[model samples]
Target chain A: MDILRIATSGSVDDGKSTLIGRLLYETGQVPTDRMQQIEESSKRRGLSFTDLSLLTDGLISEREQGITIDVAHIYFHTPARKYIIADTPGHEEYTRNMVTGASQSEVAITLIDARYGMLEQTRRHLHIAHLLKMSNLIVAINKMDLVGYERSAFEAIKSEVESYVNQLGASFTLHFIPMSALHGEGVTAFKDGLSWYQGAPLLDILESIKPRNIINAEGQTNFQVQQVLRPRGGDDPDFRGYAGSLRTGSIRVGDEIQVLSTGKSSTVVGVHKWGTELNASGPDQALTVLLADDIDLRRGDALIAKENDLATSRRMTASICWMDEQPMTSRKKYIYQQGSFSTKIMVDQIQGTVNLKNGELKSNHQVLLNEIAKATFKSASAIPAIEYQEGNSTGAFALIDEQSLNTVAVGFAERFA
Target chain B: MKISDFPRSLENEAIYIFRETLAQFERPVLLFSGGKDSITLVHLMLRAFHPLVPPIPLLHIDTGHNFPEALRFRDELVEKYQLTLHVRKVEDTIREKGLQEETGKYASRNALQAVTLLDAIEEFKFDACIGGARRDEEKARAKERIFSVRNDFGEWDSRRQRPEVFDILNGRIHPGENVRVFPISNWTELDVWNYIREEGIALPSLYFAHEREVFYRDGLIWPVSDFIRLSQDESPERKVVRFRTVGDMTCTAAVDSQAATIDLVMEEIAAAEISERGARIDDKRSEAAMELRKQNGYF
Candidate 1:
């Protein structure tokens, strides 16, 4: 069964959690005991009906405050596929959290309150989806019941969202679903509402939408060695395999590959996966490979096809989403990590920051938390990397704080400078 | 090449997490409980660092209420993989801390293992501890990050967690602060059973149907073991049963079943309505039991 990773993005009161809860309840995925638990909690909180929001609000602070503060991983299964919904916060300050959800998701559901057609927070979400390269967009016109289930109301909201997305020039499989998450109409099962609206229910669309297989880069073969495996004792003294997951493309025995960082080339002699030898392996396969010749390779090294033109760079420009409370300053040193490799790098210059609310780019000298900025960075040592548009895993990097070691920012390589 | 050349998704993900732990942490250890989930973790660890013995050691917190078969399985795996095994006992910790173990009807050592584990972490100064926890197992775990950071006191502050985006795991932490890594967080209970069946991994005998001395308690089957103090009304009876999850024998209940093979076990799980954690008596204390335990340093 395929796993469909989805991210739900919308402003507060847009009913992301309620829709997810209805999805779970309608699909019979919510067990009886769990439902009883939710009911009791809802009653304690003086809710008139069973508050679905209480289901996804797992943290104590979230329940006490009655708002989702972080990303909650909600899982449900249909006959066709399994779904992992990364329900993200809708507040503007939680843009980093929204990016966190969008980064791993193939589809993004940007909800629109029927009363409020489209808001700045909605545009902010769509912009991040574009930045993260989300392939699918579901513009769910929620709370149709509040508007008397009028067809004109749904159409207006849908076209408003379509124009906004088109204005942003994002190419995603656009879907529009009109539903009331609270009343459970047109969500998992269609109920008596909006007879003029003719589209598959939100749950059906979610199940039918095939998650784009993107474990690796598109149209490119890239492999990063995560670890070096050498026989410890005489049991397999001759075995020296490069253990790593294929970021993209495929590799087979006898395939000549280049060590990108070192410029050394070697032939694949064997491909082993969990005691089973395979003739070939492709993206996301965590396998071990033996080379025909002995070469020095360590973790964070890249192994690509001999013909590919991946650059070895000491300086590069990338679009970074700042995550830490501390502002990013020029000439400040941090650990730049891509794939499994980490190198000391200094911020050269802050090009500009994106005004997330309006999608405007402003020349800025400092990058603050939850802001997206294009910045040039200079590394102390040369490293192999690619542009984010070229390949996500190969091109994306994270800045690690020297003191806290917390991931301060997420960056996508734009060019080798 | 066919897409079949790609490794299974969940297994591949677990391997990826294992590799990340090895790359990021200086002193990392795998928390093994001799349960199927931990067993699966060990298997993935081997694959993650194939052609060589896994560099990390195995840490087992013995609650002293474990089944004999589970201990035997743990020993065999440690020897087979040539892994360094670290065993911390709750009984020892209770004696040293002058802590009182629960008694009477709800007596159990399940929660006490958390103190033992915290002590072990402090003693060894391990920066990362890999666990086999899955989100589908419980609700609180559903909100856990893949690289969950614990403070110096090993407390999990859910509201104050680092935002993890994409495949990039933030393993950064200050000294004395440790990270609890859950590689199989996305996997469901059925996913685990399916993987075990596909891989043909060995499990403890308790997972299979066998005749055991058991007693009825709260509509669940309780095993007659050393740690359990049976009441006069609760007499031990022979029953054919198997364990869905292996934990402290005093707290982990058994389910009535004759399914001895992996295929039958899969069938039972598919048709079963109750969750795997439902059989865990410790979780019956309250609605927020797991969350409270997690806040206080329980894996």
Candidate 2:
């Protein structure tokens, strides 16, 4: 079975953890011991019923404060597919954590409290989901039990969100479900509530959505060299192979390829996966490619189909989400790492920061913690890259503070400047 | 075109991580515990550097309370692969440093293994310790990153964790500090079993069901071993049982089953009610037992 990655986002008290806990429970993923642990934890808190949220709130500080602090990955499975859910914190200050979780997810489940309607955090999550180009957005209107499961309460919030999303011109397939995660209503199946709802339950909607594979997209072959495998002491003596995963498109034996860094051309003599040879290989498979000609190719070098053109530049404009408490300013130097490539880069300019409430780019000189902004960067050396919309592997990069060595910002390349 | 297979995808991800660790770190070692998870890591590492054996050595922090079956299996594996094996015993650390050992029933050397591990790290100056930790196994592990950094004292500061994006991992660290690399952090318990069955990877005989002297305790089965101090009232009974996870004899509990093969084990796990870690007695000490151990450099 294939894996389906999902990210959950909701403000405090919206019951994100409860929804996840209910999903795990309904799927029979929660074991008896864990169930007992949560039951006892709930009892220790003096609660009459089991508080399922204790399962996802794993951190000590989180349990003490009764709020999620960071992203926790929850794994479960059904007969059809394996599920990986990133339970991201919904607090305003943890937007960077949300981005980090949502970056690898195929679907975004945005939780909305029925009583409070649409809040700023809800809009912010939706905005980030859109920015990440997520196509499936499941808007779970949670806590319907408090609103009496009224169709009117659901419709009012639905219309408001519908108009706002339309204004943003998002292309996500929105699936709205009204239910109470605490009571296990309308989660896995509709039971004793929400008779007015016509859509499938939350679990069904999740199962129906197909995980997009960028590997199959029609694009140029891009393989970033992760390591050069040279088993000089084995059965065969002179063996040199460029080892890496195919980031985009496909590659076959006898295919002519060009090295992006050295501009050297070579023919693919063999494709090897763990010493076994294959005629051809598809994307996302970690394999080694042996070249007919001996060319100097090292890590941080890219091998592409000779005919395809990948942009190689020293300057590029990217939209970045600042994750560090120290604000990002122009002319500050950091390490820009894309795929296996790493280079020293200077933030040339801070163009503007995106206003989450509205889809507007506000002019800003500095990007504070958890804020999203567009900026231009000048790398010390030219490197191959693609537009973030084109592919994920070559288009994304992490900015690291040279002094602290902490990942300060995650940026998506918009275009080469 | 060959579509990506589920297990193969996970395998490729793990292989990528293994190669990346080798490329990034100056000195790296695989933390092997002779458990199914670390055994799977060894299998993947073998495939990662096929013609040539994995250049890194294997480090095993022996608690001296381990099962004979696990220790025997560990030695045979090292011999078969011609692997460089480093065994540092907690028994040695306790005697050499005059460390206090826990007394009474339920006292375990599981926690003491961390001290031996940290001492080993310092002795060998290993920059990266690749482990077989999976996020699905525990709640605290769920919040940890693939490249988790630790201080000079081997303390894990969860609050100061660096954000990991996409498949990119940052292995950069300061001197005297090391990163704990988990290549199989994404694999679930079932996923490991499924892959093990698919690949036909050899495991210890303890994984399969056999008649063993065990007794009931805390609604769970406990094996009769020399290391564990059984209560006066407790009596050993011969029953067909198997271990889901292989830890020290004092902490790792057994399960009553008749599954004598890998297929049966997988089927039993799929139908089992309790989680894999449920059999681990160390985690049952307190709600934050695993977290506390992890913060203090427990692997």
Candidate 3:
């Protein structure tokens, strides 16, 4: 069975945890003893109904504060596929945590309380998902039981979200499901409500959706060299392989490739995936390629197709999400970790922060915590960068503070400035 | 349309993590415990650097109360692979520090291994220590990142952890600070068993069912050990059992099962109700036992 990773974002009381618990309960994934424990905790809390959120709020701080502060990964499986849900916090201060959850996910689900309609938090999540290129979205309109299962209420929120999507110019395969997570309605199947709605249930939609396609499906092979392996004289002594995962496209034994950083050339002598020697290697596979020539290669160097030399420059403009408590300003030095390469970088300019409520790029010099902005930077080394629109893995990078050594920001390349 | 269209397998993901660790850290060591998960890691390490021994060394913190079978298996693998093995003893540290061992039925040296682990880290100056900790084992581990950073004092600060985005891991740290990398953090117990069967990896004899001297406690089978202080009424009984996890004899628990082969073990794991760590007596100490131990540099 294939694996589908989903990122879930919802505020504290949006019944996000309840929705997940209901999913687990419906699929019979929660064991009997665990369910009994939840029941006992619910009774201790003096709730007439079981508090399903108790399952997801695992941390003591979260249980004490009654709010999720970080992301928790929950796993479940069906006959057709396995699923991993990256449950992220909804508070604004924890926006960085949400980004972490969404980074590796192919689909994003945003939960909306039926009464609140569309809040700023909803827009913020949608914007981040779009920025991350999440292909499919499920705007779950929850708490339909409280709204009398009215079809108009669900339609009202759907239209409002559609308008925001249009303004942002984000093209996502959007699906809206109206249900009560507490009652397990419209999650896997609908019952006794929303006769006006004619669509598959949430689980059906999830199973039917295909894995997100890479943007440049036909892009050339771009392999980043992670480590160099040399076996000291033993059984098979003449083995030297460059180990890394293929970010895009494929490579064969005789394919000629060029180093992106050093501009050297070599022919692939061997393509090894773990132990076996494969004729070719595909995307996302960890492979070790033996080269025909002994070239000067180091970590963070890339081996690209001979015909495809990525744009290399020392300066680039990018959309940055500031995650540190210290505000980011021009002329500050930080370490830029791009793929396996790390280089010292200085912020050349801070254009502005992007406002999610309205699709506007406001002009600002300072980017504070939990703020998304456009910025330009100059790296000490000539790094190979591709525009994020081209679906390049090297386009994404993280900035670590010089003094604290904390990753302060995540950025995606926009253009060569 | 084809098998190639599917997402990456858990093996590929783990291999990716291993390569990343080798690329990012200067001095990295693999923490081997002779358990299935860590043994699986050893197998992957071989494939990851095929035809060659991995540059990384294996570090084992011996608690002086380990199952004899586990120690034998560890030595056999070390000799077969011709790999470097470093052993640190908790008993030496216990004697040097003059610490008192618990004198009850549930006395364990599991928690005391933290002191020895931190001391080894300081001695080796290892920038990264890779382990086989999976999130599905315990609640505290559910929130751990693939690359967990530790402070200079070897403490875990889960509250302010760095946000790891996509496949890019930030291994930058201060001089004394080291990172703990969990390559199989997303894998489940069933997945581990399936991989073990698929890869045909060999494990310790304790993993298979055998007749052994054991006693019952808290609905779990405890192996007879000198470290454990049994009550007056408790007596050892022979039962056909196999260990689900391997740790110190005082803390690890066994379960009654006739499933000896890898296939049967996989089936048993699929039908099991509780988590693999449910039988661990150390985690049963308190609500935040794992968290407290992790904060004090326990792997």
Number of the top-ranking candidate, with DockQ as the measure = 2
Write down the lDDT of every candidate, Cα atoms only.
0.83, 0.87, 0.84
Error of 2 at B144 (Å): 1.3
lDDT of 2 by residue, B166-259 (tens): 7878889889999999999889887898888888889999999999999877888998888877787888899999999999888889998999
Q: Which has the better DockQ: candidate 2, or candidate 3?
A: 2
TM-score of chain B of 3: 0.96
Query: Which is the better candidate, 1 or 2, if ranked by lDDT?
Result: 2
Docking class of 3: medium
Off by over 4 Å in 2: A214-218, B1-6
DockQ of 2: 0.62
lDDT of 3 by residue, A199-260 (tens): 87788988987754334444668888888888788766777789887777888888999999
Weakest ten-residue segment in model 1 chain B by summed lDDT: B1-10
Instruction: Give the TM-score comparing model 1 with the true structure, all chains together.
Output: 0.95
lDDT of 3 at B256: 85
Docking model 2 quality class: medium
| B1-299: candidate 1 lDDT, tens digit per residue | 01111126778888989988988899999999989999999988887887577788999998888899999999999899888999999989999999998878888887788899999999999999999999878878888889999999999987667777667777878889999999999888878877887778899999999999999988999999877778778899999999999998888999999999988888887677777798999988987788999999999
* Residue-by-residue lDDT tens digits, candidate 1, A299-352: 888888889987888989988889889999998999988767888999999989
List the DockQ of the predictions in order. 0.51, 0.62, 0.53
Give me the candidate number with maximum TM-score.
2
Residue-wise lDDT of candidate 2 within A173-274, one digit each (tens)? 998899899989889877787766778999999889876663344467887788988875767878888888787677888899999876789999988888
TM-score of each: 0.95, 0.97, 0.95
